[model samples]
Target: MLISSSYATSPIQTYKQSETKPQNVVDEAPTSQGDTVILSKPALDLAAKEKGREFSNSFVMQVANQSNQKAEEMLAAFTYGLNNPLIDISSLNPATGNGATYTRTGQPVTDASEVLFASQNESLLKRNEILIAQEREKGTSAATILEKVMQSIDQQPQSYKDKIDWSRLSS
Candidate 1:
């Protein structure tokens, strides 16, 4: 008689490998020897240029979204460096002769004021229309055009001396 014996096999043995640190891990902290990396001049300049470009792009978008009237107001404010133009009558003390108080007379000041105002308004409207046409022709936004214009202005030396020379030449 042949007897077959079956014995339970040892449960499958499993062993977890020990964890090892990654080979590429870097220690970025400055060394006690005071070793540090400094940005080169070119890198700094490039960073500054990128920042200026970003600011210009943002400014252009802001200006582009504005209406014609709003754009004109922005232009005027930038040119004059004044956000709000008001008479500020409260600051006027007539006794000090620092400010003049106006009295409404039956006669209006010379009709020239009206004419000048109309001409100036017409000029601004025409300028804005031209700018709009240029923007359309270039397939670009007003802000981009304005930014280019501003850059050109910035490149020119606009010191007091330059202004005096310009005035002399014009006169």
Candidate 2:
């Protein structure tokens, strides 16, 4: 039986207006990760040629030389070459898995992760400098505060006069 999806739903029924049963239909939504790719057949042919490469001593030496070189330099050369990357990012469709178009979740950096990491070191440094500046600005020393307190005590002779006032403390 070939029942078409288009002909399945025709009349829209309402609970408040109509006595007829309402046709409950579900709509399919398209999901996406949104990735771009290239579909170059020439690139694929070049990859096939590489896969069937006659790896002689010279080929091995060339590869070793490229590998020994810096990654950026190697990548630059490879990008310029026809057999740049075997993986065909340009020829992928999720509806039919026939190509190498897959989503990689992160941006790979050539630099160290610690370098890439954003730190509060600057803020911490600023705060430390601020604390040091504030400390410097505070001209009143610990010894000075203690001396002032002692002077105030000396001004009141009764504070030094050994009178405990035990009756008031007890009450």
Candidate 3:
């Protein structure tokens, strides 16, 4: 005669809400280190409606990182195209460590102060010019890129939770 035994592994755990806080349902679910939280489209739309356009745009850009190429691809999904947009790259004052403002679709301006600024940091000015030119060539406006990122964010689930080891808790 022979005896055999089986053990359960990785079972889903459920918790009962505390009596003191009956109204609050606390869900402690285990999440892996690589897990990512994605926002739903309805949630994104709700955020945009509540926060306004500027905040939404800034939030999307910040989350997606400042890459014009990425932004252009996002805009393309929305059927938006950027024309040969002109970007104004102003010079910076090396002494004060200031003056690097770039504007899309604007004429380049150069004042006496700007001339001094550009001369002080010619390499930096040149790099900025190149980056702006490359972005313009991608054929999508910054606003449109931001909009696409926001839309993409909405397609993801936005909740993350960590499970607690019940064995460690004192009764």
Error of 2 at 38 (Å): 60
For candidate 2, lDDT tens digit of each residue in 5-82? 211121110101111222233468675666446659999899887663432232222332344343223222212221
Better of 2 and 3 by lDDT: 3
Q: Return whichever of 1 and 2 wins on TM-score.
A: 1
Query: On residues 1-171, what C-alpha lDDT tens digit does candidate 3 reach at each position?
Result: 011111111111111111111123346978887778789999989988755434343433443346766544433422221111112224545475444332311222235434543343344334444544565689757654444433332322221000111111111
Q: What is the lDDT of residue 170 in candidate 1?
A: 9
Reference-based lDDT, each prediction: 0.35, 0.28, 0.34
- Residues 19-107 of candidate 1: C-alpha lDDT, one tens digit per residue: 22212325586586557678999999998976555325443336544765554444433222211111123334557533321111111
* Top lDDT model: 1
RMSD vs true structure, all candidates: 32.8, 38.1, 26.3
Least accurate stretch of 10 residues (summed lDDT) in model 1?
A: 8-17
Candidate 3 wrong stretches, greater than 4 Å:
1-25, 28-138, 160-171
Candidate 2 regions exceeding 4 Å error are 1-112, 115-118, 140-171
Candidates' TM-scores? 0.27, 0.16, 0.19
How well does candidate 1 score on lDDT at residue 167?
16
